[model samples]
Target: MSWPRKPLFGSIRARLLLLLLGGLGTLMLALFLLLDFSIDRQIFGRLDATLLGRARGVVVLLESHPRDDAWQELHELVPEYATGGHTDFVQIWDAAGSTLLSSASNAGNNLQRPPAPVPANAPLFYDLRLPDGHRGRAVGLRFAMPGRADEAVLVVAEEREQVDQLERRVHVALVMGVVGMGLLAALLSVLAVRGGLRPLLAFAAGTGPDGAPRVEPLPVARMPSELRPFADALNAAFARLQAALGRERRFARDVAHELRTPLAETRMAVELATRGAPSAQVLAGALASIDRMQRCIDGLLALSRYEAGIEQAQVEPLELVDLLRRSLALAATPAGKREVTLAASLPDECWVMSDPALLERIVDNLLLNAAEYAPADSTVQLALITSDEGCTLRLGNAAPQLAPDDVERLGERFWRKSAAREASQHGGLGLALAGTLAGLLGLRLHFALEHGVLWAELGPLRPIALPESPAS
Candidate 1:
């Protein structure tokens, strides 16, 4: 058979892992972004609090002096009092708005501001491009200096250069961490998929209908709990398909084998009639051969269909004792002529859901086989019994000892135990057909030999249940 075209997305394991990783990565990225925003807000808020506190402290320091000396004290406090590093710049302004004191030694290069005087009592924090063309954050504090007639101001500013540097470092670390984690996750996903799907891959590699290597189904012990059901289902389907395919192949081979005897007999009969003059004895022998051929053909056809599983039987409640009595009576006349005793020991009114015709056929086949195989004076015993669980039908006969392995091979079409009788009798398909019918009726058919007696048992209907009571 042609194979399904190879999928565009190959290796179910890889595709499954990639899909999981993609989703996991997206979720991790979202979490990282949220965390980054929270960190930025907290850092900025803390920095602003520190700046405001320091600006207020400068206002207190200046309260002690009316002159420029007080501003000098503020400058001296910068190295000890400022919260940040060298990037912090502090400067104080006089009433006339001339620069009084600066933390930087180069006070002449003090940062230039807009011509607008510090808007009265309106402390402002804003971004500016310094004379050096670098971005800076300026915090202007408007307050009255100590003992001064007019309120003065102190501006404490820090550069974007320091904050930008810190942010860049954090960004690099975050990117590295995410990329590393993503790569690790991908690797882990591949490993997980490979390990998880090993059973499926093994199953695929070893399974097919013909000339395929046998793969023992993966047991539940080998599977993860989540995957146990999938494993079990696949195993069941594989077993059924394999069995059905085996049955089809066997059916074809058995059909050809079984047809050979009848065709040969018919051909021999035709040859005999054409080759010789019409004597009464010769014509009689030819007619007998023709009759045997026709009987064999009919038997072969019936056995062929049953073994091929081409026929479906209707099942309903059938009385076991009645069915057994009917089969025994039908086989009794021929069995008596052969000097074989046919008897049935059955329950009075036991019932089962099975195809009545098929069950009768099964009984007939067994009785016929017993009559043929049993010693001339021996008895063929058939019995049907019922209990709380279900019913069983058994047939037993005294016969030549059968090897343990031969018991299993007995149901094969045309397989005979007696080499002397092989040429004269039909063997394999008869028992095989009986077994097939037993299976279709949802019964277990078994064969055993004990103390030189051959016995067969059929049991356990599929829809077995206690009989329902009449409505109250």
Candidate 2:
């Protein structure tokens, strides 16, 4: 099935920018709130001091004069108190809570008053709404006239619109300043993230897919310290992929060369049959040629599927003894045709953990190779040995015609001994397939030429009972 391609949210720059936005925005909000609180505390604190200072001054004036005419005398001393935009009102309450003196025309008619003040306590400051419809602040204090034994309550209040207006102006400026800072931070975050990721971008740009493998490394020296390790790992992966691709290309050429032989023979067979030579023998030869082509195609398919790394192996616990017996039984007919004796020294219960179908292919290929290559009237030996370290299976056949050099190239694709090059059905892929399957099943294979004999050993299968080592 095909799907639409979508750009991933997998960019380092976008992630970094989002992270900075969240973090910086949170910090700015907290700082703005703290600034607002500090400003309110300081402004209100100064207002309280001013109110209390005026009240204290009025109390001193009252102590030096008589109560009946004190308000008039205070107005004469400070004429601005009689009428002004930022005027203060002073009220003195006697023991009975009756007004003794007032800055306004009438006593107890200005604003809502507070509880009588105590001399020992701190001054009480609060908001007030005057009868004249002005909003202001008030401070209440307790005092005693010099000649009187009775304590009196004194309250002083003044309009606060001017101070409040100043505070509102400062608040607007602070909000604008913080908002501007946030915008600046967002812009900087984009530039910083782009600048930081430049090395990675260069690395991507340098490594374009031109369909050829090359030993090119990412420029790790130009990247930041944080990305150097990742670049190093990427370079190592590129080297491995290049090697794998090289092997695949070589194998593809070998397969093409191997297929050409049977194709040419089949073409000739078809030509002969069309030229008045379509006898049973001629037709049979063509059929045989077709069969050889089919086998070659099948082998190529198996090898390609194995190399492509697509198939999921269905694994199970398998007994190797049964698999070996079945494989030898299949190879017995060919061995008997050449008068070769097939012998095995397998244990009663040789167990292994592997995919059953794949294991069968491995065993069949091993037995077939031994049967096909053994000398006439010779003994083909299949032996299995197990120890604490690992297990080994050795398949050896007497081969008087086999040379030392050919043993080394045993598992290579389409490689065959010069003496056996004329065989049409065998493509020399049997041992190669066995080696590939063994490696896939976590086993190992080695080939050697002993005294007038070819030895192929497959070993180190993961133990069925013993724990397998964890793959790195």
Candidate 3:
């Protein structure tokens, strides 16, 4: 099957690649610019120094020889200045600003002169076009001749084609280097991002061959620290889901088991009626069987609804004493039929925040269960004990046949003390339904057995104070 397409920009891998390359590209561009500037500065500084030295040498030649001979000696001393197709050029001016001597390379063409006068001690370097129309660097200075009182200005220049060629070559190399490094960095970033996300991919694929989630918990020790908390949360969620599934399976099995006998009895009653048994007795037997089946079905439905969160508690302030008294009164007939006495010690007005209907069901179930199970002459004792933290309603009765271990199983569905007790009107769902309802109302329902007495404690229900009335 084809998978759904995801948006291009929504991929985390794409976003990370974009960020890594964008940042590194910027850094590389900056590095290229800086290196270009430094290399250019160093190359030109050396050229300027060399040109200044040549200008100094021209000054020394003019000082040592007479004015007439110095011009002739210049050609022999610096032969490059006199050669044809040469790269070097030199010129000198007298005190009267007239050209005293010129290199043969000039060929009657003049070099570009500076607008400002040359300094006596330091040479001035500048860029200019030479006589042959090539870009060149020049250095000019003023110096005193030996016999004359006036100083002469000398300018020396050289063609810069070689220097320009070298600079271009260096720039091309730098561009190539930056581009290569950027490409390498991009490749490495892709590898690192994929490797870093491998664990997450593995975690997402933690399923069985049938594509169901595995019940086993993930190995937290092998996981990266950054993902451990996420792994732990998934493990907890899976555990809860597994437990809910197990409970549902058991419930389904128990429901089928409980309904089987009633259905069989109903079929037997109808068969007896067909065989000419007394019509009234057959009808009554069938009705009783149908009623038992209905009770079991209704109880199962109620438990399922509560567990599935279909029923929500409507909470309000309720007087606990009044609700308890009503539940006890309703349970009196059942207790009297069994010859079991019912007694209670409650506070005057114990106000509590609880769902009225849900709490009433819980109290009624506790009272009925106690009364039905207590010995004929024994009393079912119920007491409301209040404390600073909360109030607890304890209901206890004689349970001579029950063991301590049985107390833990008190709220299980369809659990009876004996098969004979199954003949009673209760399908053994009273305590289970009560416990489920109490949980929905955020109340605790606990059971304990002590010295042949079974105690059911329902709550740590904190008391709510009543609103004070306005004075008339």
Please report the candidate that would top TM-score against the real structure.
3
Give the deviation of candidate 3 from the true structure as CA RMSD. Answer: 4.5
| Best-to-worst ranking by TM-score | 3, 2, 1
Residue-by-residue lDDT tens digits, candidate 2, 1-472? 2332122236667668778998999999999999998998899889999888888888877877776566678888776566543457777777788876667532337555774445545788888875566788888888886666888788888878777998899899899999999999999998888887887777666665574544777778877788788878878878878766765786678668876777777788888889994878877877887887777768877876776565657778888888888889999998899898998998888777778898788878888877877778889999988978567888899877778987778888777677456554776788787777777777788888888878877877666775679999
Worst 10 residues of 2 by lDDT: 1-10
TM-score of each: 0.68, 0.73, 0.82
Error of 3 at 95 (Å): 13
Error of 2 at 148 (Å): 7.5
The collision pairs in model 2 are none
Question: What is the number of residue pairs that collide in model 3?
Answer: 0
In the range 137-199, model 1's lDDT, one tens digit per residue, is: 666777866656777677766567777677777777887888898889888888888887887
Model 2 lDDT on a 0 to 1 scale: 0.78
196-287 in candidate 3: lDDT tens per residue? 77887786776344656568998989999988998898788777778677768867987898988888888988999888855998889889
Stretches > 4 Å off in candidate 3: 1-10, 49-85, 91-101, 104-107, 112-129, 132-134, 139-155, 207-210, 467-472
Would you list the clashing residue pairs of candidate 1? Answer: 62-146, 63-146, 413-428, 413-429, 414-428
Taking all chains together, the TM-score of candidate 3 against the true structure is: 0.82
Model 3 scores a C-alpha lDDT of 0.86
Model 1 segments more than 4 A misplaced: 1-10, 13-17, 20-50, 67-69, 76-125, 131-133, 140-154, 169-261, 276-313, 339-349, 372-412, 415-420, 423-428, 442-472
